[model samples]
Target: MMISLEYIYRYPIKGFPGERLEDARLNLAEGIVGDRKIGVGSGAMAVNQSGEWTPCQAFQRMTIRPDLTTFQVDRHDHILTLTAPSGRSETIDADTKQVEAGNPTVGDQLPVYRANGNKGYWDHPDAALSIINLSTVDAISQVIGQTIDPLRFRANIYIRAKPWSEFQWLGSQLSLGEAELDVIRPIDRCKTTSVNVKTGVADLNMPALLVRHFGHLYCGVYASVKKSGTIVPGASVKITGKSEDRIIEAAANAITAPALPDWPRPMRVSRTVEEATDIRSIWLEDPLAKTGSLSNFKAGQYIRIHNLAQTHTWRSYTVSAVDGSRLRITVKRDAGVGSQAMHSFNVGDNLTVSGPFGEATLSGKSKAHHFLTAGIGITPTVAKLRYLYAQGFVGKVRVTHVARTASELALWDDVVDAAKRLSGSSLELHLTKNVGDTVGAKLGRPDPSKLAEYAKSDKADVHICGPTTFVNSVMAALGSIDFDEEKIFLDTFSSPSVETEMRPIPASEPIRVTLQKSDITENWTPADGTLLDFAEARGVVISSNCRAGLCKSCSCKILSGSATRLVGEEGNDRRQTLVCSSIPSESIILEV
Candidate 1:
């Protein structure tokens, strides 16, 4: 049966009551035209001072003032009116007011403040719209043993659908009325959901209830407008095919078979050589080059390589050298399985290689280019230099390569040679250790003076890539030199570090993992590296690639409980976790 939109609501001011809408206009860039166009703030956390969006915690919310939900709000053009349950009313003009005078108070104690803006305010910067499933709300109500009001979720659109069916739409396109939206991720539930709309009381613990029932505290889905148009209540909704399958197939074929356009074609390793200490370079060519040559790629692009016969681990490496017949990738040996396996590759070895992807290439519109990198991060810069040398690019170019020691410089000679071939190009090498005039390179890390000199040009495009610390340092140095942030492009191979500390699940205290789609529950312990490993061992097929959590192929919604995502340094605010690196912190339910 087809799902239909049942309700539409818009919050003219964030952290306040929402107004029901009979119809709304969705824009590709801005979600609902007037939804959350302004936000309420108070004291030092005010948004008017900085003119930037602040987190919900900085402002007064329903969690702190449940009475705010009892206020009825309506909007007409630029004027907004608010009416209290006690028959008190206040009207304010949005366009002219910098701050409303003596605004409504919560519990007659805390004063409410408002921040006006034309640009929409949002929780997640990219997600402009949110949707919830009616059946899922009903199911949650049944589990909580209460008649739950869907308005507690504060979603823009409520759709009538099968219970938990909306989770399957992740990464898929949804056609609602004349507008199209791409479901990006599930909306993680917050303390706001605990506030009861009817009684104006924080009575229900929605997050705890969600964890008790689903494993993850998510109640709705966040979407981005793809094709903008008008949408109204009762409009039909259509979800496209499963996006998880497409991601899995693309990743698998990228390493095993040949898929055109999006997927990489199969190639054979023609040669391998140790370029420097702990560094290896491999040349790849189309096995069936007689039929057609390999696909052409612009400079600064990288390819994904995986050995299906060995393991599912895949790693991306920048194309160090490229030609009509073949391409080469330089690798720095690490403790990781992918790098170790790539280091063991011999000539004539069959391996799957996919697509020359990356956007930090030499911009055709740029009149000057500057590259800042360390160690293996210089691989893409080398490719760009080679392209410039071949094309006789006479524009100004500067490259700075930094390494702890001279031995760590993998492609020093190639970069020097390419710089000499380019008429106006220059290369500078820096050594953090081993400083001497005879070393033929600068001493210590990158200096701000060099970046300032390069950034003086209006048409200069700066690219930086390396370890997190190195990248951050270079960015800071660039900023000190007044470099344009918009012109800076970065490519880092490492994922953000996981911020949350997770204690290992005790072997004695087995964690129960329930897979919703398969209706199977498995007991797991610390011995299982991650939930993905445990699930796969039990023949519970889940899509996964880049087991290190860099690739989000294994990301799934946590229906209940919690999972420790061991990816990058950033903490996951979303309810979804990467199953490959996630260990169950408690008895968890996953909608994989």
Candidate 2:
């Protein structure tokens, strides 16, 4: 198979048209000379002039400002010219140092400043080059029934390679012209790609379509320049070497990889911090971080940990924070089996864990967000708030947390820092136990009728995390205020009052259950409580977080027969069943 560079693009100004290049020079630790060196402030982002890297949300981009794609850009000797759809034109005089466009559609004349010096401003701080496979874009075009403009992806390097082959190139070394690159990881696509380059209209949901059709959220690859040199179009591309683990992962991606969450892996507890009298925060570090397994996790997701004494017993806890390959979970000491096991752990101990699972994660698409949490339920909210702070979000963020006391507050300082970092963001604490004891906290529980005051707008994404009663009350109150039910997200991983136990099968022909991936077949009996219990008894590790069936981590596809959900909300796809709560009616084959 022949692979060659097809095109090179340089975005002189972010959110503006890309300038096609005939030839460009590459340097180590820096991308194309002028690429993304300057970006204009918009929304909550202030003008940055210190040549420092800023998050993409800090500047106008096609993701939120699709109208910017309607303009054409050309740079000749520092003078940047842009032409609007109406043929009206504007120019930025780069020689004066700071350049600002006068077009209304382009960031509304937002102040522009050059930053990041030679490194330039990139979506990923360390990733300098974005490489795209033209064939992969064409494949998506075919699936969407429309021609796709690769420029919409805003990638710097475009290559002509086998369709979807670039995904397999991750963790591999690439050679293009005189430059060498370390293909780091697959680029998870976003709504930015949905914009029509010519019309500048977002006519499609690109990320949703990718998940629906391809079963993954990746398209291009982000590479770091290992050995840089000048390169032009038509330069030959070659794979120099492949990492063994990545090769195995590539093979899995060709089959059932995308559907499978990370199975239980033993991570060493590097540190344990006492956040409160009964609450402890444990930080676990993945030994093999090079595989990048822990890096894909999102905020507001939780991990399932196996009970130390009872390996079969698993419990779910929301991840409080993630730093590189290290993830932290804050747990409160309680009579619960999982909580007791977590409290017994110490530094240097290894814990069996799986899944950063849960549907309650942020899209980072919306600007306004409101969080209402109570007691220890602030774990997930803190994680999400930190994400917004890192993105430099300036929009209104309303946080209302109810706690017994300030000392019992998990991540209180972290939440306060987020509130301080985001301008116009508010943080209010409600102390139901002793309100006057805490400095700025209200004395009593919040009135459900007055909950509408917590949100600035009805369109704000409302997140509720707390005890069942608190959650239900807040949810009902938010509903009363006419908040969009669909826009509200909840962390409902609480255990049911009555835990379902494995029951004996009826005195009839035994049910035959097959685990496809495990290649195991077993007969069901009364002793096997549920499909999950049966799989575990057979030495088949079925990835599961909440054994009560809330997180849906142990969900499996039914190839034939039925193992229906016992209770809970129906999943988007009916073909899958939550094995923890599901019982085999007759016989079933599960794609485990």
Candidate 3:
């Protein structure tokens, strides 16, 4: 079902360059262990801005020390000597390298990072955990109307045949099977992507696409380092997270011919809400219908509905009711495709509910204070507020509901009812129609003091669910207050930005993959489709994962003939290719 990585790409330099691998081992047990193990950190990372190396935040950067894919480092002084990929040896002393190579340096002294803190090149896990869904990437691009390189997110794992035609955000936890992960949160993008990963050149508009389509700069999921193990290319993937409903699975599974049993649970409509003229309450049906009671849920948990091909595409709503049999979900019918779709659903719908998911489930796992920023419809915020009130656990809690006018305040009466019902617990609601009060301007952005009013309360656990601007404003406000990152939970609805376009045809010549020892050569003509299709037809077994180059699967080593594919590895002569979708030139020989 996937592509096998015949080779791996290792980048010793953070943004400088990378090396190719004919043989590389995975330490899945250790998260991003060997990946990016050795990065030449200049005091700052500067993408080539306007054709010149620009100074970045931390340090000036270094390429794999001059064409060297594999390196042996000696950091005794502020100097480094590398055996470069070009096979031409050179010494890179901080000050001299920048001046000699004309590579600009932000500061005189740069921090040279070693992989696994080693001065020598060796094995390690991916520097950090990463996963990419080529199909998801494609879907996301379609919405944004741009071509997004999966590598921009820097994922270590790539998935295909996902249940949905859209890029799936975390509806449930994914079990790598071989490893454990503490997924932190979705990454917010930065200006870095504006700069090409390969060329270090800044493309201001590129970053804008991420925001316009992805809702944020980060397209990749950020996972905390947890368990590590061996991960082979072409390994099967299983999604095992709990959900607010099984709607995602239901919609996706409906489209998949031969059902994949491991689809994540779908989020359901809890109780319907008349929070706004365009909003309503949602009632979660069940994660696994009749599998178990729904009482396991804590307050502040959210669920998303997968509206495939319909008006409502996907929307994550907050839960209102606290009970198991029936939890409450609230949503606003914004004039968006996904929002419009959600407004059409009705009661008795066989919606599936998955979680009890999310790190900030307002549970005992986190002993900090809590902050809930409810804006606009405030349905999701009101749900958690009531749940916390019912629990009556002794802790400092603050709730801020912001709306344009009092009439637009959604469910303050219900929120007050929960606060009164809880009695003796710390719960306060702040409202504002202007800048001086509330979370920060009915229209202005959120700031530290304003954000801290909620986030700073007794080491609060902050939960934000709203449009892109609202979530971004809240996060920035909290950052200024130095709010604990672990406690901040954001539910930015996943939106597809780009629409896939017609890519130029791959090389006209057929691709040939030969297994030297086995003497098995697989040929794929454009007419016959991809090499993977050819291999599957002939029963040629080679590991493969993501059909796109996103995953390492189908990466091949060059034996002869210049092949057309993405550039890779130090000293890569352009020989290897991702056979899953790549077509080769005239006559070429490859190890299957």
Per-candidate local distance difference test? 0.69, 0.72, 0.46
Model 3 global lDDT (CA atoms, 0 to 1): 0.46
Which residue runs of candidate 3 sit more than 4 Å off their true CA positions? 1-8, 31-33, 44-111, 117-127, 161-185, 205-208, 222-232, 240-279, 283-327, 331-336, 343-592
For 1-592, candidate 2 gives per-residue lDDT tens digits of 7999999999888778888899988888688888887776654444455667866666777755688888778777988887777777777665455545534646366666676467777776666789999987888788668888888788999999977667556667889899888776567565577788888887775754554444344678877777879889999999998545654354225322333334344578999999987999999986435455666667788876653443234567899888887889999999976788899998988765655766645666776888888888999987898888777776778888898876787788888886788886888888877755666888778776576555634357778888888988987787787767777888855332323332333444578988898888889874575787677655565654434454455789989888645545432234778887777776888898
lDDT tens digits, residue span 432-530, model 3: 454343332245333436666655656667767655666677777777877778677765432343321213455455556554544667665665545
TM-scores of all candidate predictions against the true structure: 0.42, 0.46, 0.41
| Candidate 2: C-alpha lDDT | 0.72
For candidate 3, the TM-score is 0.41
Clash tally, candidates in order = 13, 5, 106
Better of 1 and 3 by lDDT: 1
Model 2 TM-score on a 0 to 1 scale: 0.46
- Candidate 1 residues lying further than 4 Å off, grouped into runs, are 48-51, 101-118, 241-592
RMSD of each: 19.7, 22.6, 21.2
Worst 10 residues of 2 by lDDT: 495-504
